[model samples]
Target: MAEDMNVSKGKLQRDLGLLDAVGIGVGAVIGAGIFVVTGVAAGVAGPAFLIGLLIAGFAATCNGLSLPN
Candidate 1:
């Protein structure tokens, strides 16, 4: 597979192990999305995204606290 050029620099800077390499790649994509997707997310999810995120976070916390990790 071809290396993702976007992740190469971060992986190099982090002295990435295999797991870190995977994390670097996901981080690179997520960072780009945050930079590029504001307009799209706002248009699609509208003013409710913040509230939705909070609700989801609360649900996640409740589930985590209740469950065996």
Candidate 2:
């Protein structure tokens, strides 16, 4: 039954280390900062900022998709 299911019997490895954990935490903080800054920017710039934001998002999506997997 296990063979039919094709499940791996090998044990999973613990890969993440201290630096990886710290990097993840820093990324989360920066992500939150971006949101806060974006809100402030929208308030200051009004409707124009939203159009720029949409354009920036599309560019970012294109950049992300271009990266090698």
Candidate 3:
């Protein structure tokens, strides 16, 4: 005798819109770049660290977009 097991398997909803997804990606790249590049940027560019951060972020975004997946 098999008792009824109400196992619900539903598709997870996609709640994030395009802008929200893009913003999250950009924020993640910038956030990670801060820690990873701060020392290098400070050593190389001194007061131009902010520009380094921007370039790093842009490069990260481009890299992310170019993936085959």
Query: Best by lDDT, which number?
Result: 2
Which consecutive 10 residues in model 3 have the weakest lDDT in total?
1-10
For all candidates, the clash counts are 0, 0, 0
TM-score: the better of candidates 1 and 3: 1
* By lDDT: ranked, best first: 2, 3, 1
TM-score of decoy 3? 0.37
TM-score winner between 1 and 2, please give it: 2
**RMSD of each predicted structure:** 10.5, 5.8, 12.1
Model 1: residues with Cα > 4 Å off, grouped in runs: 1-22, 34-39
- Per-residue CA lDDT of model 1 for 1-69, tens digit only, reads 126544554355446599988999999999998867866876799889778778879999998889565
Model 2 C-alpha lDDT per residue in residues 1-69, reported as the tens digit of each score: 556656566744467999999999999999999999999999999999989999999999999889686
> Which ranking of candidates, highest TM-score first?
2, 1, 3
Best by TM-score: 2
- What lDDT score belongs to each candidate, Candidate 1 first? 0.78, 0.90, 0.79
